[model samples]
Target: MSVDVTWLGHSTVTVDVRDTTGDTGGDPAGRLRIVTDPVLRAGLAHLRRRPRTPDPSASAGCDLALVSHLHHDHLDLPSLRRLRPAVLVTPPGASDWVRWRLRLPATRVLEVAVGGTAELELAGGAVRVSALPAHHAGHRTGSGLSRAPRDARAVEHLVRVPGAFPARAETDLLLWAVGDTGEFEASDAVLDAAGRAPDVALVPVGGWGHTLGPHHLDPRQAAELVARVRPVHSVPVHWGTLHPVALSRTMGDRFVDPGPRFVEHARRLGVPGAVHLPVGGRLTLDGTGQGTR
Candidate 1:
């Protein structure tokens, strides 16, 4: 058994869990694909995707899609339409927005609040996704002072695949995505949400603009989170993806420096498993908690 992760760009990632031990009738390999916070387009507002745009095939055939908040960058409707996942999990108050924007039926869209869990049954095994607390603002306009929806809030997600490791039947493969959060003391709560230490963690290292607010984590702070969670493997995200069109030349370093800077800080803190994955890079994690790029 192994899990393959591909960082498409920004916060979007595709996690494929393969169960080689099971008998997948029509679907050989018994693979389940899950995508997170997909922003597939080349441009959004004043921001433009640097280097290149994401390939549509990267998010193709996704079983489930997870939306962290109501922010436009995290929950792009056009990108969601491209994937057309069988199930879409979003924050508590954003169900209606998803339904209205994507015209998806109520049966396909699920709203999971903090501490709430949603289970999905696959051909190979079962998956449990739990919503955790996030410190970032959740308004669509990116401002708390604006007239935002009362129930809108940001959340992190914990994805657990039962029996993913063939060697250890009692241990499950846990992947925690700390979506758009700041430096906070939620280590205990995050550990409790996953029921144990995470096998893999996808952490945000930077934001889109020149300045990151107090709600966002910088490179050093991201490394601190990795030290606390202590996952078997950690991948840095939310950097080196988008930037303002005018500042693409002036702020080039800001768009491309966080990932490497995080690796540096993680090494100083004696944090193992801090891997920096470039855009469209793929990493494979085997049953023994080892990874190959």
Candidate 2:
């Protein structure tokens, strides 16, 4: 199969990355739009979502929706509910949570633990979604998707716990992909057991604050990830968008320049073709070559 991809900022992507042959046309023999962790709302606890926009209708009918982990930004219930996916691919036990919140039927949300995948048939054809890695956490505030006006001071809610240690940072536990981690694929064991690298991976390389944690892969690090996974083609996401509230713009370049950085890395790694598309731009790519319109 061949595929086309569009980067919709952050971890959210419109992946028509199906197995159909190349350039199958806009509709393609297979143009299944995969909404990976869509943070559709304006503000998360502290970060302001980017200005990037996709055809709202484009997300209307989807073959499958993939929630890589439970991070609030990644597994946003409000965003997921709007998409109205006929099928949802998520981590191990999180389905119960999504189901509880969205009131979606048990069959609608196909729950797969980390290192597992689910196959679904779409209009164009079939696509496989594998639960990969993400360096963030998740939660649904009692008051669903906030309705209050913006706090003139910051973009998201800030919690302060001066010296208390954070959970998920302790190596002793294998909690969901929440909390801080090094800027490495700290979970190689999961990657290896899958037996094959992801053809298209949606990874997190940014955070909700001025500082970046180790577990997150910044754009440059993302490029390194590309060098390792070496998918035939890739889309650099989780960057150049979304900023924390009350925080000054000082944490700029790390989030702003990751896209181009990935491109540079791809070149240095001899990754022949790593295409980074515009916010809503459409692309048809393959190992055959690269072109932009």
Best candidate, TM-score-wise?
Answer: 1
Query: CA shift at 2, candidate 1, in angstroms?
Result: 1.4
lDDT of 1: 0.82
Estimate, for each residue in 132-175, the C-alpha lDDT of model 2 and write its tens digit: 44443333343245321121110011011111112223211111
- For model 1, the stretches where C-alpha displacement exceeds 4 angstroms are 21-30, 142-150
For residues 41-113, could you state the per-residue lDDT of candidate 1 as single tens digits?
9987678888577777777777878999988789887889988987899887888777877889998898888
Cα lDDT, all candidates: 0.82, 0.53
Candidate 1 scores a C-alpha RMSD against the true structure in Å of 2.6
Pairs clashing within candidate 1: none
